[model samples]
Target: MSMTPPPGWYRDPSYPLVERWWDGTAWTDHRRQPGSVPVPLAPPEPAGHGPDRARAVALVAAGAVLVTSIVTGVFVLGRNDDGGGAAAVRTTPPATPSAPSGAAAPTGSSTAAPHSGAASVVVDELNGITLSLPKGWVAPSDVAEDDLVMTTPGTYDCPGDPGLCRHGTVASRTVTANAERSPKALAEQDIDDAANTAYDRDVLGGRPYRGITSHRLLKAGSVAVAGRAGYLVRWRVRTGAGPGGYVESLAFASSVGSESPVIVRLAFDAGAEGPPLTDMDRITEGIRPTGDTDTGGGVGSSIGPSR
Candidate 1:
């Protein structure tokens, strides 16, 4: 019996409702073709690779839509005829030869150049002190600051108020002898001075040296920076000011090439009775140096002033 199919884009009833009798083949009209050759009736495309090929082609089209949307500063969404879901639109890329993997390299790309090597500094954190030095050798600290001779020997920075500053300890006036001193030393000196001058606290470690003084605080480990080695130190203390005024100190040491050693010291004081030790440990534990290569650079020695 002769029957009328649905009006628009319907497949013949004899076919699987997939082959279009209008063009007489599988659907290929992404756009209306005015007078092209009518597609001939053919067997349905094989199921497996056909779907995969269709997916790949859809991805390419999506990429093209995306580029166009980006250039126009607008978003464009699309969907397949199957009603799966909306998809990201993309702009078409310039045609290029496909590689064996069926993917094309980006056009107008330059060859990747090799990186140049710079003089490397390695940090080895030993015990509680950190040292920035060459690989496989102990770095030395001299008793002189860079060209600024210490008028008073062995004193670091002057002590500042703990309430006003992070490092609660005071430092004596001392010369930073070697330009190669790790960041740790300078921070220790600063902390010492802050504790001493501000709160009348004594320094457990002397300037550029360690002392066996009473410390509610401590330091240890190695923290590296930018392929250069340095160390980390953690310390804790209590103050007589606010209710349970406790202070925690942690320092990151990194040797800046030819520049003064960069010491990042962090301190937190909640009260005179908080868990300064716990806080100190937590902060110091999070210090990790980035951009370090495996030339064996790191904190190699204990965290403390070398005897």
Candidate 2:
């Protein structure tokens, strides 16, 4: 006695701001803003069996509520599709189950499948750069307020307290507030802020990792990133609560010809539960300019470990 919703637009299960096509039997790829015209479904076959059509429509409608609830809850953790300019360092926990606030949602699906091989590039059009997303890492789910943030699969309870935490995160964006043009100087200057943002406290005033107590420089020197000259500073920091982690600040010139300095911050918790530390070097070496493939100066050199 159940009825299926006919072929029409329904509220998108993944994002609440828009609607997606729900075909006579299942969901379709078509999506549009709330009030925009819906994409027309394909023409029906010539006078198909009346019972078959009716059955299909019934199935679609019958499962509509269940599918919507499941999909919405699964992808509700950390979804932010806002396209904004550079801002101060802000580390917030994974968004709550409620729909995240932002401008227009992204046009494509919100699934955060892991990338590999040639398709592993994570393009950050906002910063005009791209980085190779490692095998276990997925695209940004708005874990932090950076232009782009690629993180490991899921989150866990922070050892410091009861909040959720991601063991690994790599964030990138252009440096608009600072006037420094030297990559080395910028990298050194930003390391402290990076450590604090990642470990000290979140925007909600929660001390997830408690706070950074001390840090030791692990690496500092010139290098190349995104086809531009850059410098990186890595530190092994100790936190007041949980096992501390590694933080790296890399500064380079933008490949978009604006010469604006770009910064990439990396944070990885130390322990077996966290991602492999080697991922740091791999990610740094995989950065490339988004569009132009001129290979400005090859991969160039890398920063060596220091005391």
Per-residue lDDT for 1-307 in model 1, tens only?
2222122232222222122212222322111111222222222222345445333321112222111110000001111122221221111112211111211211111111111221122222211122221111111112111111001111112122210112121111112243435455645544543333223432211121111133455554455433445455444444444322232222333332333344333333345422243433332332333333333333333334522
Residue-by-residue lDDT tens digits, candidate 2, 220-292: 8888787678888999989888788898888888767586887888988887866788888888888877666
> Which TM-score value belongs to model 2?
0.62
How many clashing pairs per prediction, in order? 70, 2
TM-score of each: 0.27, 0.62
Ten-residue region with minimum lDDT total, candidate 1: 68-77
* Candidate 2 segments exceeding 4 Å error: 1-118, 142-144, 293-301
